[model samples]
Target: MDSAVITDTKTSMKAIFSDFKQLTKVGLSLSVVFSSVAGYLLAIDVINYFTLFLLALGGFFMVGASNAFNQIIEKDTDAIMKRTQNRPLPTSRMSVKIALTIAILFTVSGIAILYSINPKTALFGAISIFLYTSVYTPLKSVTPLAVFVGAIPGAIPFMLGWVAATNQFGIEAGFLFMIQFFWQFPHFWAIGWLQYEEYKKAGFNMLPMNTKDKGAVKQIIFYTVIMILVSIVPVLKLSGAFYIHPITAIIVALLGIYMLYFGVKLHRSEENKDARKLMLSSILYITLVPIIYVVDKFLH
Candidate 1:
């Protein structure tokens, strides 16, 4: 082969790989995988490394597939939004045919791997993709309730991990789902608050009232309160597999208080900086709550 041809081929491959990264929205997909892993760890009595690996792989592919489909569906709208204008689809770095092919492959392989774990896990994985791509993607422009609808699929991965570990849907899985479901409100609202103009450019109404009015800020406070309340529920001995130690409870309460402080600040000031702080605080709160729960479980 000619040296020039080889160099051109290498460059093409690198470009394709970079586009693939954008198509997958790797950071967001990985975060979803992390939540799934946390749920698995919280549920498993015996740590199975192989099962954990499968769960992470399946979860990543599932989320990646959903995001790829979202980008493909929103390619035109994405091109108009500053934040998403450079995505592979929007930038023409990748073709719709190729992106769709990749999404289908990811969906098939992801569900198959989850099925290897259990059918229920696979079922929920497929449902998450369907709801995200078919329902949430289109609904963004239709109603602010899209956030509520989208929250269903967004909240699935955490509980999906527990379902994979125990192969059952019960109060424990429900509790995990509820915590994430409620958490989405404040988290996404702060994002919607910060990126209001960008989202408007894309015709997305993600905020509760479709505006960053006092009503929307009030809802953020309401949901944050509910999220904090729900976060400590596992510590209350209401269910069999979901109780935290007293010390862990106190620790989680402190974390919730810290997050709630930001939520309240956003409510009081209605400033973008406060909303940004609440957004970051929400991330920390979600990340820590799972770790503390799993640690408390192991210790007790």
Candidate 2:
């Protein structure tokens, strides 16, 4: 009986972790880590191992707090959508009270660690949580423009990590923020298009309610063009620690154009699968383009 009880306790612990994963949205949190690391790396003259570790740990909690609060706010809508129906809060596997407590605790702890780094880093982190939870979370159901609002907080981790490293915000950090900010349009629109049906069922107005693909596709291509233009801005000048040769910038520009071509083609095709493909391409481009920037910075 004692052995059986031990096994049951361990099983329960595993189950609890699964529920916490749902609350934290682990994949999204890790994406936050990637951007934060990229920013931290770009801003620093030499990487400090301890500082990097602290940034990662604090960033994880900040992201987790945002995600947890998002889950709490959307628990009702989550239950309505097939994609989110089984989440911890929606499925009643965890109480709303418990989720709120976790969210607050994570947010506070994250902000405190960031404060230890610098005032600006902590301020930005607190703002991100506020915007994500108080503004973006509810705006999802009310307007399609929520994507714009969401992108502000979403793109912040990159610059937040930079500020933590450099202790100052300037053109260099602004450029980094712009890259993530502009990338969000194509990335999120593709997601909005791909998940329109599910989102509609949940009363989330992600895509335009009109079902018109032309305007949406146009926006994607436009942003892709803008992204390519802005992405190369740092290459034109000796801006900061970041340095990219014109040739590398051209290569990155071509990649952006390659992505833009798909966005335009998807618009013309008007196929759901093609739209999904564009979304995946957007994901790949955003993830890789930063790596290219870091590599170019090192090589040039």
CA lDDT of each prediction against the hidden true structure: 0.91, 0.86
lDDT (Cα, tens digit) per residue for candidate 1, span 1-300: 999999999999999998998899888999899999999998988989998999999999999999999999999999998888988998898999999999999999999999999999999999999999999999999999999988999999999999999999999999899999999998999999999999998889989879888799889888888887887877778866978888887888888788789888887888999999989998998888888888888988
Candidate 1, pairs of clashing residues: none
Across residues 1-300, which tens digit of lDDT does each residue of candidate 2 receive? 699999999999999998998799888888888888888888777889888888888888999999999999999999998889999998999999999999999999999988888889889899999999999999998898898899899889888878999999888888888888998888888888888889988888776442547888888888888888888887878567666788888888888887887888888997778788788877888788778877776765
Off by over 4 Å in 2: 208-212, 238-241
**Predicted structure with the largest lDDT when compared to the true one:** 1
In model 2, the clashing pairs are: none
TM-score of each: 0.96, 0.95
- Candidate 1 wrong stretches, greater than 4 Å: 1-8
| Counted clashes in each candidate structure | 0, 0
